[model samples]
Target: MFRRARFAVLFGVIFLVILRYYTTTRHSILDVTEGKTSGPWREEWGHPIKTKQSKGANDTVHDESDEYVNYLRVLHRKHGFTNDVPVATRRIKAKYSKPPLKARPSLAQVKNPLFKDPLGFTRARLDSDNIWLPAHAEIPPLSLPIARTGPRPSSIDASSLLFGISTTYARLTYANNALLSDWAAWLTDGRGSSNGAGLVLTLHGATESQVKTIRDELHHLGIDVTLTASAEGETDAGGRYAQLVQQMMRQRHREPDRKWFALVDDDVFFPCMGRLLSRLQKFDTSETHYVGVPSERADWVIDHGTAITYGGAAIFMTAPMLDTSGQLLCLQYTKTSGQTGLADEEDPGVGMAWDEGLSECLARNTPDIKMDVLPGLFSPTTANAQTNIDDVQRGGGYASGALPLALHRYRNYHRFEAGKGHAVTSACGEDCFLQRFLFKDGWVLVNGYTLTRYDGGVTAEKVTVQTPKKKSGGADSKGAVKPSERLRIVDAEDVNPKERYALSWKGKKKTWRLLDARVKENGEVWQAYVNRRGGGNTVGGDMDDRRPGDIVHHAEEEKSDVDSVILLIWEGEGEK
Candidate 1:
């Protein structure tokens, strides 16, 4: 029985030892996969080191079993216990010289099944096993290369430019109308004109005199004036006026050669002809088909009349823009359809509507043709014509003034008259009519001073006076003083030739003298001398026995000698 019991005990001890060894090996494998293992079990720096078991103890122990077990577990996880792992290890030939630095496969190689398959399958294996190979090829080539190009040239003809003018009936009066005629003539003459650009006179009604004057003036200036008379006897209402003007423009466009047309009013004036031509010349007819002189109408106060459009009186239209065929649709759209409320009283005149209408038409039909408002090119003078009482008071007043560049509410009777009763100096006369118009259109009315007079309507008369003065003895008056010979004392200093003058007294000499005297008179000069220290007495007594403050006269003497001199003196006590 004792022998059997000892055998059982031995068997149990062997089983327990085997169980502990298996658990230890499994634990080591877990530690290595979880990155908790040290020494050879780690990815790099795998060599094991000897160390003391406790913090300060001098004792040490061999840990080769633990390290060896960890290494075997790592090998099992990486190589799946395959004979290939052992063969790969032998082929690489692990050496004590740095263990090959544990090189990682490149992305290309790792992505390729032949080198990177975790199952150890090569490209040949994929092919034989009917597995689809993934592709890593470059993207398909792009279609083709395109070449770059430069901007295209403008199709506009700079030679054939046209301009138009806008104005009301009343503003173009006699003087203003004449001024406009003169301006047109100047422009046509090419001396101070728009370089021979075609001139067109657009008016509300064609008066016989206005037409004749404008025609003659424009003819003289060398401008071919096309007088576009408004439809006769038509009432100014609704879009009818604008429509009629558009129709007229369409008719004018029939002539394909007419390049540009400028919109001008009868009251508009041009100050510098060179500046006007320069502005018209720089116009980009190719790109911007419609251009105008911008004007401010919101703040514009027409004291004598009504405010017109916000745009200046002048507008220039290119030839191509007048080609109505291209803008037919846009024009049709602009035409009122069944009483659209958008067409209100604010709608500009027919010509103005045509100008603005062309902008919208070109924008929609021919977008390439831009619309620009030239800066500082035209000025609206009508805005300046709305003068207040204060302006007249400060400026003294005006008479027969030059016509403004433009004018509002101009009447035919406002012309300057020498004897007319209505000659109150204000800005609203016929003179400012043209000035105001041209000013509103951005065409600066330069030389404004040359156009009008500052003072007018006043008259004057001539008068003569004589005064007696003491004269030197003549041949007929031996001992008898010749009744204080008559002398003429003229008030020549009244003109105030010198802006300022000074008077001083010499205390030491008891005398006073005039300095820088600009005297012009027919009389003898005698200065008043006073001796203030001698009891307020007067010195340099005169022959007339005049008091100190009394007038002393000197007259022309016929005698050759006798010291023909006279002096005047005054006495004062507090002259110090």
Candidate 2:
């Protein structure tokens, strides 16, 4: 009996020992696995990537809860009262948004089994929602060369080109600082007067104090301004004061070397002055030239004759044309809208748009003088700001194949500020923005716009880049083709060049549009491209109804977190 009892106790002890050992081992394994994950672990442990040479990628990890909070910090540092705010108030990131502002907060990581390798931060239900967040701005490689922005390289006299813009004091004070910054970037170096091009500002109803405040801002920005105000008008949008030619002729007369008076709207953007001078130097400055780009809408163009220079596209009038522009003093634009495509039979105009009236008056005087449509100048009238990435990727009005001469309706059609996007020019020089480069990893970089891993593994060898259906040029000195409702611009669905390139592959492609760009003290341009669809989180469809504090059991049930960012750090100067 005693021996049996001892045997039973020993057996029981053995079983207990074995059970304890198994439990400890299992927990240790789990502890190690959990330690390998957790959000911040990605910084220490590099994840393995697997992608096909041509068209396949697989990634199953991302961050769901945390996002890099660099936007607010940047806003504070750039535009906020930096001098008044305490040092603690300057940053949204803990100790990260320091002087010179590198602006890259670390991306936290989570698990997502649905995505491929190249789409590190992309959500699975991309059809439902997507977002673009600011990533990192590392100096980009200097392997490829694009045109740079600097002083005039050629003997072309850029001083002959004088630019003008008309805006109200309220409009000029509120939203035009960034735009005026863009102007300064193109026309002047940091101290202004880099290219010797002049800028004339016609504030519609600015008070003396308002004008003084703006002059202070412009002087600090390095743009020497030829500031003036319009005569008392009925309305700021349009009126008898819209007669700008007489006032502009006075400015034109002030400069003996003035060859062209480029009267542009407040939104017109010149990416590179050298390119503008080159395009203009092609034409005879002595001739009576009425130069502009037609509106994108065929119906609008038909309503306003194609011969009329669209104001936003800029009215580039040569010296002789400026001389004649003064004669149209009779064709004054007014508050009461006038008839389209006519100028009161060459008398004081009532309802016509200033640009249209000018065309009517000029056509009446010199019947042979034609409207010279500037090549590569785009005026996207029917575009939305949110779809700028898709529009450019597919080469809709946002053609990246060629560097633009001037882009009108900047953030109106495009999402980015012209100044920020053009910052790369300081390092890469002119013509670098929106330039394309394909990489071995099946990714492509559209300089200053997007870095993309296209669908169907579109590499340099496989991809065929085609622009949107070429917009028909303006009709000859005659009127435009009968207004057609059928004329639709190239961007129909979400446009990514890959979609247009691979007709066979119908799957989705991914893009990381530029979210933040800034110039460092060392002259490097740091650009961060995030995988968010900007404008809004959802791309094509509407969002689902949701309650607060809900825990999702499956990955597919939750919105994708912005845990991925790609960086393109450009060296301050490219290798010559």
Candidate 3:
């Protein structure tokens, strides 16, 4: 009996030893299969570092596990997975009108399985800025408030000009409040937008609420916009930029009426949209054309493999160039291979700079297309080279008889600065224009005098006044100089020999009349008082200023000097 009991105990002990060995071997196999067995999971700098692996009994785990891990990583960085998340756009109620339509689902939301929510926020891990979202994959539809509630402007011809501005959410306020406001005033308050013009804004990581805000504030500008989030796992900067280019191409396809398509930074300034369009009219948009001020940093395209289209000022492409198959090829490359070429990589995201990426795209897809360095597109002053706004504008010396197409680096100028009516010290002279008039930037100085009077109108008239002569004891009894009469130049020394000037007088009845005047580069000769009506107000003003020229009143008394000139024209002259 004792021997049998001992045998049973030995058999039990052997079974227990086999069980322990099998368990140890299985754990070791899992360690080898999995990358590495780390410590307990922990958060580091908003990114979740998973240290421990799941010890689940089941082998076939859902792919969502990895996705959830990524989601957690982004969530911690953004909001720490807060349950008290504020419902965006929930408080925006339409009291005067019905609430805006629910935002359309983004392309990524519709196509990518990773983005489950249609319009809801998704953590797109792109760059250190945490900007990209899945919504960036598709282009926003062409949506703009119509003139008579019709489709987008379809009238296309050689004079057609399109403006495409690139911006981001962090800079949204500047774009809408400052830039767009200035643009609208130029279009509505000034005649700069006369030649057919279209504006489009492209933004990234723009939520529905943000889009609604921009649309509501800028509806009157007749501008179209494409606002979307970046793609998921598109950690590379180039990937996000490629997506922007694709959207621009798609926008051009949608609007076939424009001849020239200009891509610019949000801070860029279109001093005079009309003049820019006219200059563009000189170029053939149907041919392959790439226009921009080349950057010094673009020299490394061959060795370091980076090219850039000095985007601070402007980047332009003819409609034909954008319509080419090469652009489509670039689009495909961005979509398939990825914008930054790091979306599918196992390592961290390294985004390509937009300027470099765009340069590469244009070169690779359309090698025949040559990038034209247009010095006129940038401001002559170096201060305006980047997006710096502290100094005179890049194109501040615009009225120096040199018409620049665009000015880069208005980002630093606040709306208040533009409103202060301060002329650029470097550009302004006694009778010379100080700075280019960005209609929104204070008063328009023509020949160093405010173009429009306080009443905001420009009217032409003819007047006669006594010319100023050397005080050679030629004074009347009333202490007025009874000198020979000619024409009056605001300041003879500052006026150019070739340029024309006008003397404006506000009659007792508030009627403004313009008198033509002559100026010589040398202070040898100039007009004292202009008594003849030659040209009308250069800029149109708000409604009530338009009046018949037949109401011209005679000059009551010859003013000593016609310094404060005001153009007496009304909004009726505004075509739109």
Candidate 4:
């Protein structure tokens, strides 16, 4: 009986020791897993825990939350703040508001086949998303020649151009700054005298101090600015144009030496101002010339059966044209109001849309003005079929040779400034795509299609490269081109290094040039339709055998090995 008792006591002792060791070891393992010994305490969501500073340490916790809020407040005061701030801030706060719930492995979930393997399930979902691409691929070798920055044309002077910008007080420091910088670059360049170039800011709802501030900002940009108020008490959106016209007339009277007066939107980007000035230099500034591309509203109310110059792409008027209109154009514009057409639904005389209103005034007042419909001088969106990118790609007998001049309604001030933020960049799909077209560096990829100039000059090759297209009904098939996608250009190193392609009209040569192949920003080569001076155009003859509306291709097709479908050429002294 004593032996049995001793054995039981020994077993009990062993059980106690094992239990103690298990408890201590389990705790140690958990501590190591949590990294509590070697690192600072972290929350469940991987954020550092906020700790109170102890009296022993000299260091104190510093919170810049207030400062950040104040900085945003100041930005709001100076420039309008972003619209998504409240929603974004609240969402972030909500995400870290409480501790993340530890997900327990439920038997119900385990039973479901879809959730049987967590890793596999996640992989499947990611595959379905189609957002992720393969990290590396065998991109075909491209041989694009590096473009040379040629000498600035001594014949062309940009300072002779007068720019009248239409903007509001709020946008001066924000959206307009980008354009102001470009203009400043041209003005600061010693090639053109500041006296030859001038800037006029037509502002609405700007105070005297605000105007002064804007003036100072322009002065800092190294250009003298003339600030003018929009016609007071005018309730029409078109009233701003009246104000600008009036201001331009006054300036025309004041500065007779300034040759070209261009009315561009505050966001209008003239990538090649020197080339533009050269084109303008060909025309007589003393003659009444109305130069711009035309736009028409689908509603057929205001600009019905008439081609009106889209103001955003920019409208240029020679001094003589402005002189001929005198004050009649301004008076007519002011008399028209946004509410004029709304009052009578039955006979809504042309609504006070700036483009339509300006068209009416010019047509009625200045009959002697020469209207130059250079569709290439404006953005492609100003055309009749605005949504059709194929119209541009096909280049069916339009001014296919002339590069696009300005991108209208392409505003992306959100990157630099604050506000609701224009979606121009987003709309273009990717940075590369935007840079290729809108922010062009004088080259465009022409794949499987030829573009002919208006004068029946250049014809492209007829060859197709087998490219992969997204399956008819897939996730990636729906959206525009994916971001950061690189497109390959075939044989883009075949242009004379010294000779530039120039656009010729009526025996006069302009600096505009077109090349067959050109290099893009990412060192990729493209069978490009390159023009030294970028602008839009409408061809007159059949660009290719293919009919219009049949040239639609998927954005992903850019990755395909397409042939040199574009035939671009330079029409000048040396290029053949």
Candidate 5:
């Protein structure tokens, strides 16, 4: 009995050791899609089994959890128990740990499976958010030669012209002095004159000293000088100013009798004054009221007017043109309001109002006057009090190709403290609003080679003010201002000769034949006609042969008489 009991104990020990070995060697199968694990077990007959469950229930029924636990126990027996085993109460909870979070898909990942990778996901995110990204590949460098088609014709004449200067102040230290001198010199040079013989200087609000200096300087150069001034504390400075100018003109007009009057501001400079003036002198004004300088701000409402706003500083007006309408033009421009201390703003509604009103008054009051335009003459110059002779030299005098004709120094007076300023520059601010308005009404402006610096005893920087657009409806439907519409014309005006010629062929055999025989109008090809018979049999030969008197189809292209046209003739043989 003792021997048998000992043998049974040895058998149980061996069995336990074998079971632990199998458990340690086996792996657990995890169901990633279901977010769970099948647990660990030993294979029996190619199937996993739980030692405890197999003994208690039918072996055919598999229990994953039971199998897992049994396998753990077997491993503990063979490899020694580890602290990693969970407590009995925590095992169940651990099996159902929070379900794995789902990943969010990107736009590209959703669109293409191949782009489902992380890199593609990043790109898709950036693209969907409208973020800029670097290109994936480097671009090859291009090597091409620039070819000139032909030489352009010169449209401007460089001699014998007149320029005008307009001003409200005539002080020596005013910022426009240097500018005016430069303009005078440029005009003299451009006109090929030894002296500024035709240059007319018109001054407004001239002090006694200022008038004396201007008259003396201009007199020495043989140039005409007209100084207009108002009495101290006058209520109507504009009217007085106008009267003074007229008086000066009458005095000069009665003398040598000048043919043209150049109206210029005291502070205007003329860098290219000579070239522009020379060009102006060559223009035929018999059909126009005035020939104006080219300007960026041109208005369309002024009749016979080209949009080229000139600086009130420098404009060229014919003596006859002004004599005919000068009084009425001055009358219409007369100030209706008392001087307001508001020097920082433009008084469009005050001192001087509608540009159209001024133009209309001139047109109605003077019936024989016409107008033309000069190109590229006037530009605003430095108007700051801090500008000096040195600054003018560094900035290039009015004669510099890029220099502006008119400079405004008025703002410097109000902005910065006096005495602390250096030299004055620019009279009309940077944009020169007044210059634009005048140019739009057909006025000639010139910036000569000389600098006309103003030392108006004030210092200030110009500021831009935005005007709110008026609403069309009530507050509820208010909207921002709409941009003006633009029209584009294309055809012979835009296309080249060779390209235009090829466009005449419409692909239809009949149309092609008609186009081949068409003649050109001016220098461009006119309309073409195509034969319209079903084939060639109805007209003459076989169906394949060309025919006449069938039906005629016209070419798509047509040209006006003023444009150039080409004549086309058929070269190959065809049935008549």
Candidate 6:
């Protein structure tokens, strides 16, 4: 009996020893403190580390960049919330009229996906400052009152000149209409959309029903826009852009007080129409003046053998220039594009962009006319030749002392399209968007862009106005000048220019990016600004981070389901 008992104890001891070994091994899987692991999951789960090899430095930088977008920052909190989320277009039951209907353009490509309820939120009133909102993605679509970006303009002066803009139905986005509505705040004089500046939208290939929807919607928002079907044979397909002046010339008799005919890309925004009107006033409208900013890309200028303007930078043609050059330029577009076989499949009737071929035609036809260069309007070329993304915009202090009248390519890299009106324009108007204001609390509010507090603190006057130095020339033309498949002269590189500016922002800085915004019936504006993450690289953003084979970085934690979001509430008119 004694021998048997002793044998049993020895067997028990060996079993315990084996169990401990397996348990310890299982625990090591969670131990990612050092990032070194045994299996083939190093590259996927491990952070890039520096090595002693020659290529190590470059590899580390490249790999680290790839990982920066690995974790997507979200707009929710982990704890203390019930599911009572607010409606995006909430209005009082009485005295609310429904706005017209237009499709909301999706900006999914530029921004990260927002994960909404299924999760809940704590109920709160939007009565004061620091109002933490429910998940922005959770807010429902418009139901009552007008969900347009801002208050409807009481008056718009359509008698001045027709402001023409062109875009395809397939390519129209939420940002497009948002910008159209925003024009009331900047371009229109007095209250609602004014007749001083009429808007003409040439929607290419859109169905009759689609055109009506957009027309009715803008009219309901108090914007009197002229909607024309720009099909191949009609005003559009590319002919409309070249012949817009001719079309507007017919209406000139009705709008006898009209001055200049301006054509801009759908993406361009006029911060203050007064500022632009002031600029145009400097030149002679009677003369054949072709005024515009040159293409920020130098290579395109070199290749074309002359300076060409990008439409997004806003192309203004004097009354005489447009009236004289209109029809001829359209014919030239057809003749030139057909000869070069540069007919675009999407824009079937037209050959190339009207800006390029039309500008070239204007030059050849009117040899005496030269481009009247507009300085300090568009953002200067990037400081470094290697980097892309130009514009005087740095952390919301737009064009500083340059006295900017317009802003372009906001959706390109900065993803500012989603934030455009909601960010600053809704509360302060376009003039206030991205403008910097320093508070006595050592905090700085860059309008709709960022709300930050520097380490030591920054002063308003100390924020000196500086501009990017122009490069010596377009991309080096050395070595055979390989013919590219497309005519793209320059494009924004993968790197975000906001990241470049982040270096100059001293101490701990937080970018309160606009997540969602809504205007109440009483004229109050509610804006949600959330911390940004996933610089367009995160993989499992909407899903739980605890999935298999996906490892969170050492700095990231699953402690909460979401990051904190900041909400700002502006009092409506007469609410005080």
> For every candidate structure, what is the RMSD over all alpha carbons to the true structure, in angstroms?
50.6, 17.3, 29.2, 23.6, 37.9, 18.0
Q: What tens digits encode model 6's per-residue C-alpha lDDT throughout 371-474?
A: 66553233222223223222322312241322234555544423443223432343433333443434444544444444444555444322212224332443
Task: Report lDDT (Cα) of residue 330, candidate 6.
Answer: 36
Question: What digit string (tens of lDDT, one per residue) describes model 3 on residues 334-375?
Answer: 445445542323434544455545665666666666665444
Off by over 4 Å in 1: 1-161, 165-173, 190-195, 202-223, 233-258, 280-283, 295-310, 324-342, 345-370, 377-447, 450-576
Arranged by lDDT with the best first, the candidates are 2, 6, 4, 3, 1, 5
Highest lDDT against the true fold, candidate: 2
Q: Between 3 and 6, whose TM-score is larger? A: 6
| TM-score: the better of candidates 3 and 5 | 3
**Whole-model lDDT values for every prediction:** 0.28, 0.46, 0.34, 0.35, 0.27, 0.42
Stretches of candidate 2 off by over 4 Å are: 1-142, 145-157, 190-194, 235-242, 294-312, 332-350, 378-395, 459-506, 533-559
- Where is model 3 more than 4 Å wrong at Cα? 1-159, 174-176, 185-196, 224-237, 293-313, 325-338, 342-352, 377-403, 413-576
Better of 1 and 6 by lDDT: 6
TM-score of 6: 0.55
Best candidate according to TM-score = 2
Which prediction has more favorable lDDT, 3 or 6? 6
Q: In candidate 3, where is summed lDDT lowest over 10 consecutive residues?
A: 88-97
Model 2 lDDT per residue over 1-576, tens place: 999999999999999999986664211111111111111100111232222222113322123111222322332232211112111100101011113211111111112221233223322211111222211222122245332333322222467778777776776554435555666666665334446677777776677888888777777666657787664454433333244565667877778787888776676677766656766676788887777643232203433322223433467888888777666644454445532335444464444555655655666776676666553433232222223324443334443334565666545444445565676776665556665555444555666665555456542223433233323653323222221222222221211222221212223455555545655556656565544321121221333222232111112212223323444556665554
By how many angstroms RMSD does model 1 differ from the true structure? 50.6
TM-score of each: 0.31, 0.59, 0.39, 0.42, 0.32, 0.55
Model 6, runs deviating above 4 Å:
1-159, 173-192, 232-237, 293-313, 327-350, 375-403, 418-430, 439-442, 453-508, 518-524, 532-561, 570-576
